[model samples]
Every structure is written in structure tokens, then in C-alpha cells.
Target: MKHTIKATWMRGGTSKCWVFERSELDVPGFTTDEVLLRLFGSPDPRQIDGVGGGSSTTSKAVILGPSDEPGIDVEYTFAQVGIDQAVVDWGSNCGNCSAVIAPYALKRGWVEPEDGILTVRIRNTNTGQILIERMNLDGSEAEAFIPGVPFPGQAVDIGFLDPAGATTGALFPDGKELSTLSVEDEDPRTRSDITATLIDAGAPVVIIDAQTAGLGTADFRQWPTACTAEMPRLERIRRAGAVAMGLAKTEEDAQRAIPKLAIVAPAESGSDADIKVMMLSMGAPHPALAITGSVALTLGAHHPGTLIAQQLASAPDGELRLQTPAGLITTWQRQIDGQLAVGTSRTARELADATLSFDPAGERTENPAVILAQGTGLDEQQLEPDPPPHGRRTVFASVAAFAVLGLGATLVGGGLLNPPATTADGDYAGETLEVVIPLAEGGGTDTWARFVGQELVHDIPGEPGFAPINDAGGEGITGSNRFASSAADDGTELLVSTATTVVPWVLDRHVVKYSFEDLEPVLVNGTGGVIYARTAAGVKSTRDLIDRKKPLVFGGISATGLDLTTLVAFDLLEADITATFGFEGRGPVNLALQRGEVDIDYSTTSSYHSAVEPIAKEGSATVLMSFGQLDEHGEVVRDPNFPDAPTVVEVYKDLHGKEPSGPKLEAYKTLLGLTYTYQKGLWAPKDAPEEAVDLLRDSAHELSGDEEFNKKAAEVLGGYPIVADENLSQRVKDAYTVTDETKGYVTALLKDSYGIELD
Candidate 1:
């Protein structure tokens, strides 16, 4: 028999998951799992025959129906359809995919808005947990940018009600916060027992210390892209954790899901995140964090006995910020209706609403597909993963998974993954171009460095080895310091410079031993952004930014990076703001504003359209304020891209009734030029052979002018030009040379205003 049903594809939070009604899948002669597997074209990585996105995050499905539980609005089950396997795993929950349900309910007329806010109480049938979901139904335009989402969508606030023991009946599934798992069988070379926290809140998760995983503290900070060899060990560890949590009978009998394993380490110094994590989803590195994990981590962040609490970088007073491979995602806890509630916001967009017909029985597989048709529990032993030879594993779940495709790249000491470009003609044919990227991988700066390094070496006279090293420590300071002290002076080693690295030197922090004056510029790029504040935070206009009854809470990454400039803007305007200086990035800051955790924030020029514009249009936030651009006279001018937005200095004029002259304004202008206009660059040691530097600059000059490169780099450049002409050095010199007056003001502001004593 053929089963025809309606389904919706949704960009739910961090991923796109299919949503379907429970009634549609109740056809005779087939179980829900059998139909979904065939519909998704599983048992193959490519999934060429089906509509699946071919990754765990994208290949997820949520089945929704009218709630039978008391006080619940709807009932649903989260299913993670296996990729490259003939199985449908209903063992756990997916927090990211769960975001689509509320919006789906509204669209399908399953729920209605109350007082302009669309709220739905959803019951996860698999875990027997209830989630209170919310969004703004008053307007149709407001969007929640959950960092790195390709597009903005309705920001759904999800609160896991009484989020404890969703799966195994106890918050601490193993009857304790800490549990040790033996991974002697998974590892080929060594036997290392792993200590983990098996908490059953939201979803059962096994949080382990990265240092205990044999990578050491240094390697974990960089967030290495490839940990393929470690996946098998982690899988076995998850099985052990499942058995320990009483979710499975034995290690081999453990299902493919539940007790998700994650690598946790203390965040790097000056990092906005409270913890650094490498989340694994169904045997693959999670492209982004699972929403369920965020819920678990938030609850775990405050409990002193949990493993997450031990790795926390902050005092555990506020919301928990997780540093994922994608970026920082924020989760919070609150007392709602006198009940302890935990939640985070996710971006939700309905991608489709359609009906489809599929066979009741799925395509035949070596393993009996009919096992899913039975009403009994999943056959546990059949779900055991096929052990790859030598304990190697590859993921079918993500395009970003750490598969290490046969490209011969060597991973070296100190967390450097060197994928050397092909050597070609030039003075340095045999040499390697080691670019010191002072940021974590998968971030914008890292992306720029890798892209530029690869392309630069491709066309350089001697296309030498390309080694882009990501040394993300001390909020980009550690890598810059290392490059300053030990980089080769022969033009073979180049340091990647962005606001993160330059701001420290601008403040003349004692830790900043490298001076921009001592380095020669190869190329420079510009970037810009606008300032915005949430309307919910007593801010109706720019005037309300100062002398308000309560100060607007400002979220920032650091007091020394690009945020230094914004902080100076706050000082210049005498804006009534209490700056919280440890958000993972501006994206998280934007999310915090949406969730009312913070009030004022900024968005990069590239992300402003997708991240902030919708919210601005919906009257949730006000934009029209720019950091301003640096003109030829080194004066602040209205950013050409944001012509309608007043410059910060101009905004100052409107508020104070005149142009002001002071060190605050001077410092603001200085930071605007350094951190925005002439923000990023490539620098070599001053004593490097001029011929080598000259040749490199010439190549970059040609690259900047090339149509193909410019076209490809348009998005990365963010409407900014890459300067590599003869005058680049002089222009860069003028911008990098921070005046003594500006330096004094910044240092004092940090020390006096923020109570930060810079070393």
C-alpha cells in the first residue's frame, strides 16, 4: 500500500529538519521508522535518491500530534534517521530540530498566539519531556540569528520544563554526577579510562575532560578539524556511558543514540565562552551544538558536582555560553511561574508544506527492515555500529565533519593542522608558508586566513608549502605573541592580523610584545558594522542610551578586541550601559538581546542584513548608527554602505548638541580606523628580505585586481577593498601608530571603568 502524507521542511535552529503529523504515518503494514528511512534514502552517505541533506543535523525528522498528556499543547517525537545505515534512532532528543514545532503548530493552526506572543507547550514522546516554546506573533519580520545560520528566521525561545531525567528517570543517570568509562577496546594503541558526567537532563549526555582524552589542554583550544581516530574511542565510550546510565544491557547492545559524548575543556583566556566543546552527534562531530546539549550544559554549568561545572571558565553566575565549532551559543536558566526553567533561543523557518506518497515497506536491506514494524522496543543489538578496521571512522552526517579526505595534510604539535599547498617556482619553492592565524578554526578570521593563504600560495612566484596554523588562545593574543617572538624573518612566516590581535598592541598591554611598527605589511583589508540596541531595554531612541534610570546591559567579547572600539563609543556618548565583557562573539550578543539577556549589541556588515535587519524592521531593535569609516584625511566619515545610519560621532553631536573634542572621541576615532577601516592584514618580520616581501606584495596587488579572485572574495571582504599597492605600508603605518593620548584613555577606561588591570 502507498502512504501519502503532508510534511514540512524547516530550518529549525542550527539545522533543517523535516516535520510531519503523527496521523500521516499511521499506514498499515509499516512502522514509522521504515517509512522515514526509505523517504530519506539512508544506507548511503550520498543519499542520491532522497531529499535528505545527508547529515545528522539535516537528516532529522520530528513527528507532531495532538497532546494526550495533561496541560500539554502537542505531542512529538524526535527521530535521527541514520546516514549510511538502515536504521532510525529514536533513542534520544534533538534540541535544534525541536525548534520547528511551535512555528509549525501556528502554521498548521494547531496553536494560537496569546497576547501577541505565540507560545506552545510541546511534549516529546520519546523522552516524555515538555518544552514551552515562544516567539513574537505580533509581527512577521523579527528574526533570531543563532550564529552562522545562512538566513534569519523566527527566533523560537525553548524552555525545557523541569528538564531533568528525561531519558533514564534521574538527573544523574548513573546515580552520581561522575562516571568512569573504560575505552580499552576502542583505542588501537592505548587503554585509557575516561571520566564522564552522565546527566539525564534534556538528553543523557556524557561530558568528558579534553585533557583526559590524551589531546592535552593546548590542542583542545584550537578546536582541531580532524579527530577521526578519536571518534571510534568516543563511540565506545558512549556505549559504556549508556550501559552505566542503565540505558542499555551491554556495550554492544547500546543503541546508536543517547548518552551523547562531548569533549569539554576550560575556555581559553579572555574567551567569551564559559566552556569549549567538541560535540559529537551520532558518531560525527556536531556541526553546531545540539539544542538538547545546550539545555543540559546550562543546568550542569551551575552544579558544582557536574563535569561541566569543573570545566567552566566563569563563576557560573549568569547564563552558560558554549564555544562550539560553529561559534558561541548561549543558554540560560530562570524562575518562571516559581519553577526553575532552562532555555535558549533557536531560529526557525518553515521550508515546505507538502504531501508525498511512499511505499509502506522500505527498500530491502541485508538486515531485515521489518524489525521496525513490530510494536516492541528497538532491537538493541541490531543497532550496534560496524567497527571500522584499525578503529577508523568517517561521518555521513556533515559536510564539515572531520573525515580527513585523502589530502596529505600533517597535524603537528601545538594544534596546528598543516595542509601544505603544492610547491611551485620562486625563491622559496622548497619553503613552507606558515600563516599564524590567531583565532579558532571555523571562525571568520580563520576562514579568511586559510582562503587567502591557499590562494596566495597558488599564484606566488614560488608556490611554497601552505601551513595555516590556528593558535586560538587568550582571545587571539597568544598566537600573535608566538608569531611575534619566533616567526622566521625570511618572509616564509606571515602573521594574520585582525582587530583581536591589533587592539592589545594599540592599548600597549604588557603582554603585547610585538609592535605593528616592527612588521612589514603585505596586504590589508577593511570591514565595517553598525551599532544597534533592543527596544525592549528602555531604548526607544538613541537619546535613551544615556542618563536612563537603568543602564542597558551590553554584551561583548573582550575589552581589548574589536569590542574595545565599541566600549570607547559607550564612553564617548556617556551611554548608560553595564558592559558584560565575555560573550563568545557579536552573534551571541545579538541572541542575548533577543532573549533579553542583554540590550545593546552590534553586527558585522556582512551579517547585518541576515542577522539584524529583520529585527530592526520589526521594531524589536533600532539600527542607523555606524562606527563610521576612515576617510583620506584620517577623519571619521559615515560608512558608505550604511549611508542612512548616522556616524557614532554624529550621533554624539545629535545627543550633546555639538561636536565634542576629548580623548574619548579621539580614542573612539583611533579604534574605528584600526579595528574597522584598516582592520585585517598580513605582516612579515621587518627584517625579512625586501625582495621576498616585494614579490609577495606584487602578487597580492595582482590578486586584489583579479576579477575572479575579487568576485569570489566579495563576501569575505565584506564590501571592503584589499589594499596591496605601494602606498599600503605607509597607510598601514599611519593607522597602526596609536597616539599616546588615545592609548592612555583606553588603558584608563579598562582599569577604571571595567575594573580590568591589564598586564
Candidate 2:
């Protein structure tokens, strides 16, 4: 008598997997491992008897269910079942497969509302967290289509919360953007350690120039020939990195999984797009990992401390195209004001005739050959006169077959590991530092906080840890509530607090449950912001704009709260300027500007400096004046990048000093100061034991002093540390304070100039 277990084999991207529901499996004889092996026909290269594809990466499984939590809608668990081994890793989440959760939930009856764009909040059971998965449905079925997957299956959009330091404890875990580890052999050489930013975005993998990896970018498709000779050496490096990142308890663990690797360089003519790359999966090379891997690598490439940081391209927030074996994967991400909002795309791959059904046990029952567990016994008397009714009803768990994992990140350091440490105040290290950041990851405040964390890992007295948790909605209210109410004064948990928090606290007053006075400042770090423009506006200079070719459309990062200042500036430029709110960052704004969608934005000078410098030098964009209260040579200096551009005061004078007023302006002023607050320190919560805070803070200070940090900072961030100055932070914060009338004026100016309406 054979026992039957149902399953559905699905293909996502280049990867394939067998998906199941928790209610599947009635076999009492098979243990969890045995059940998995039997269902997938594991431990065989052929897997001829089962749906398992031979490749290790493809031989995977996932279990999905409606979320047990109140607010969330779904739950997901991933299993990397080996083809040659019986082991299935229940730890960690797959960033790629994660894209499928919502579709799966929508197709299955686990979630409620069966119609039109349902948001299925998913809890990633593997990482112990929840993530938002947006599913587009027509009625009781899916409507959105995603690339890579077949049959135009539902397209699911995933959003990560507080991803900074998700894998690693610090955004700059090693303190330096590119640190030189003193290995005992092969010279005291310098290797890039961008684990900081990489960890911040949870892409702790290193990307070497393809040439460094001993291949040209054009040769990625010839990998079958290249891997035989060059892959082994790269594998060694990847394994070493895993150890360095502390993902592996030993070097051997790295040999199995973790610290994914990729090599990139300039793309070949007609080779898909802008840049070309080759990504590695386990030991095998990926035809293409898409922009997901690149997104992870972007942090390493852009932030201080990491090898190959210098090889990255610089462009404002927007579409970054990558050429892979499968063609192009375009990543669309940006900072709205100062927070990161990211997404990616490829031509949608429609899976045709892709349909699945489930058995009464919630297991896929479509493949008749797989029902090997069915049994026929001779009990006679009509099966003992029918067993008692147990009310065990299994409904169809037919979902679109994808999952989402968007949990609020608790800072994990070194890109791996979570451990408690005693702090300087003689308190047990806090369980975990839950940092609520008003902005999204990769924003200025978030970036600064990450840098501080990186520095602390090496310099701070304690191996203290904190992660930036982004709750970017309701202007800054959502994030602020998480911070003001949930985060305690204990030194363990802290807020990588930003200007958005201050803006709402001062202006709306109703934005958060607690006042700004309720929170305590741990330290102040650094400052950087930019006044940028897109390439298409056709206005070569401020004068060209003053000449008025057309209404120059400028964009602000936020839709409400703190964006008032930039909006006000646009108001002053209203002679020819037309502005709007809702560009997440320079990247998207740059894309929009290039596409003639918008014109200018107040981006960070430092953030855009590297990416735009080449373009600017090539005369692509005209940098406007840098705005802040900073004095230069006894007077406010114009931006060096655009010496000809006028100051805010000069522009104001030229446009007439008519002031705008109200809570909006007050909010704008408050938000503008976030750029300067970039220099402020980030720490665990105040309620965190004093000892932990001291250790982390002290270690950070110590690491900040390292010569290596200075070098990486200059190379990656394009600037050296300005060091933390409480007085400077205080002054910067003060600049945001304004009367209600002034706030209203600023708000009106912003609305008038940008057509941005704030409630």
C-alpha cells in the first residue's frame, strides 16, 4: 500500500519548485525529512520519478498559508531541498521566490477578498518576519502578470520594511566601505569590504569586476566554458566572504550556501542593456539572477567599504538595466525624499496553460502519477460501516503560487548572526534593537545610520546592533508611531530617527502618539543633500531656466510633511518652474527627467555626487545651488558643482520675497534639515543597557578613526567623515522649527509651485 501526497510543480523565473500547503500529508510513517524526500523524489540526479528538476537550486519547495496574525494576510516558508542530500534548509528566505507569495495566496482560498488588487501582507516564516505582497486580481482570481513566470500569472509587488542591516547588523558592518583585511598570506593586501551597505540592503555578496573574476562582461554567456577553469577560484573567495560575514559557523558551511557571488562590467553592444553581469548560485552559475542580486550589490558598490565599490555606475534613482543570459532585468528604485523605494522588471513571461488543483488535504492533486501513497485494504463490511465523522474538511488551497516575505527587520550584524552582549552599563545586551526610521532604506538618514553601524562594529566598545525599520506611509506618521510608541527608552532599542519624524511631530502634532520630547537623542552624525535636475528639461543653466523654455517640472521626495522646503524653493522658481511631489529619490527622478517626465529635485549632494558627477562633467545636468544654513567664507556659499547657480536667498530675491505660511511650511523646514542630520549618530534604543550602547558607540567611534575607514569613505561615499557634533545637529534641527503661519506659507508655496497637496 502506497501513501499519496499531493504537490504542484511550478516555474518562477529560471527556477522551478514544488509548492505545498501545510494541511497536506496524512502519512504517519514518514517524518518531516522523509516526507519531503519522498514527495520530491530527492537524492537522485535524474529525479526521474518526481517533479524535481536535477539542479540544486530548482529542487526547492515552499509551504503557504493565511497568516495567523491579525493584520497580516499570508505566511510563507521555503525549503532548499538538496538533490543529492536529504537535508532541507528551513532557515533564511529566498529573495527571488519571495516574489511569488501573493499570487499563491490569491489563488488559494487562504486570503479573504477575492477581487482587484489585494494586498496580502505576508509573514516570512523562515526569517520570522512579515512582508507586504501586492497582488492584482480581476475578481476571485489574479490579474497582474510577472516576467519570468509563465502563463502571465499574477504579478506580485513586494515591499521590505527596515531592510537596512537585514542580513548584517550594520549597514557598514566593517566600518569601512572598502576595508583591507590583513590575511596571513598573499601580501597584506586590500580587499573590498562593502559588507556594510550590502548588509543594509541584505545583499552581503561581493561583486568583482568581471575582469577581476577573470572574464570579460561579454563572455558571461560562454560561462559553460569559463566555469570549468575560473569558477573554482571565485568559489574560494565567496566561501571566505561567507565566513567573514559570519554567515557560516565554519568555512564548510559557506561551501554549502550563503554569500552569493556575481561579476559585472560594461555591457557589449546590443547585449541587452547598460551593464552586463554573471551571477553565481551555490556552485553553479546563474544564467541570470536578475536585478535582485544587483540591488544587493548596489549597496556594496555605492556605500563606503566594499571591494568593487568604485566600479559601480552613478545615476539618479530610476531604472538600472542589467544584461544577463536571459536578456535584460531592469531595476526601478528610488528614494522618495530620503527613503528607498525599490522594484524591478523584465519582459513579462506568461506561463500558458498553467493550472493547478489541490486534494481534500490541501495538497496538489493534478498529477495522478504522484499519488503514490494511496492504499486499498480489505476491511470488509463496507469499511467497518464507515468510520465516525470527524469533521476534518480540507478546502482547495489553490493560490497563484507565489509568496511574500516583508517583515520589519531587526538589525542583524555582519550580514549574519544574532547574539546578546553585555553593555557598558552592566545590562544584558537587549534581545534585539528595533529601530524605526521615518525614511526608507538607502535614504540619507538611513545611509548615515548604516554608516554609523558599520563604524560601531569595528570601533564601538560593545558589539551592539540596531537595524533601521522603515514604515514609510502616511508621510512619516506610520514610521513615527512605530518609533514613538513601540520603541522603549531602554538603551537596547533605538530609532535611526530622521527629519521626517521631527517634521510631523512639530507640524501635524497628531502624527504620532508621543511628542518629539518623549524621545532621547543618542548622537548626531553627518550631513549631505543635493539640489538636482534631470537631463531633459532643456534648461542648461539656471539662467536658461530663468529665460523660461517651459514650465520646469521639479519633484520632491515626499508627498506630505517635510517636503515643504523644496516645494517652497520651487515656488520661488515659479517664474518658469513647475514642480510635483512623489519622486522617491534621485534615481527615479533622474529617469523621469531623462524621459521628460519631470525636471528637478532636492536630492542629496553626496548621494548623487558619484553617480551624476560623470554625467555632470559631460554636461548632462546643471547642478543648482546647495541649500542649507551652512556658511562658506563668512557667507553662504553657492554650490561648487554649480558655481553659476544662485543661492536660495538670491533666487528668493529674484522671485520676490513673498513668504508662504502655515503648518506645511513649518513641516517643510523641519524636513529640509534631514540632509544635514546625516552626520548624526545611530544607536540601539535608549532602554538598551548602557553598557551595550557604550560598547557599540565607543566601537563605532574607534572604527571611524581607522585610516581604512577614511580611505573607503572617500572612495565610496565621495567624502570623509565630518564626525559627530551634537551642537551642529542641534543647530540643524533648530532650522526646521517655524511658526504655524510660516509653516502655512511654506506649504502654500510648495502646493502652488509643485501642485503638491498635503492634508
* Per-prediction tally of clashes: 3, 128
Q: Which window of 10 residues has the lowest lDDT sum in candidate 1?
A: 396-405
**Tens digit of lDDT per residue, candidate 2, span 445-527?**
55555555544443433233333344443334454554555565556556665555555455553325545445444555444
Candidate 2 local lDDT, residue 331: 62
Every candidate's lDDT: 0.75, 0.51
True-vs-predicted CA distance for residue 190, candidate 1, Å: 30
Let me know the TM-score candidate 1 reaches against the reference structure. Answer: 0.51
Off by over 4 Å in 2: 1-434, 438-447, 465-476, 534-536, 547-549, 573-575, 632-635, 638-647, 650-674, 677-706, 715-736, 751-758
Candidate 1 regions with alpha-carbon error over 4 angstroms: 1-434, 454-459, 462-469, 485-490, 510-518
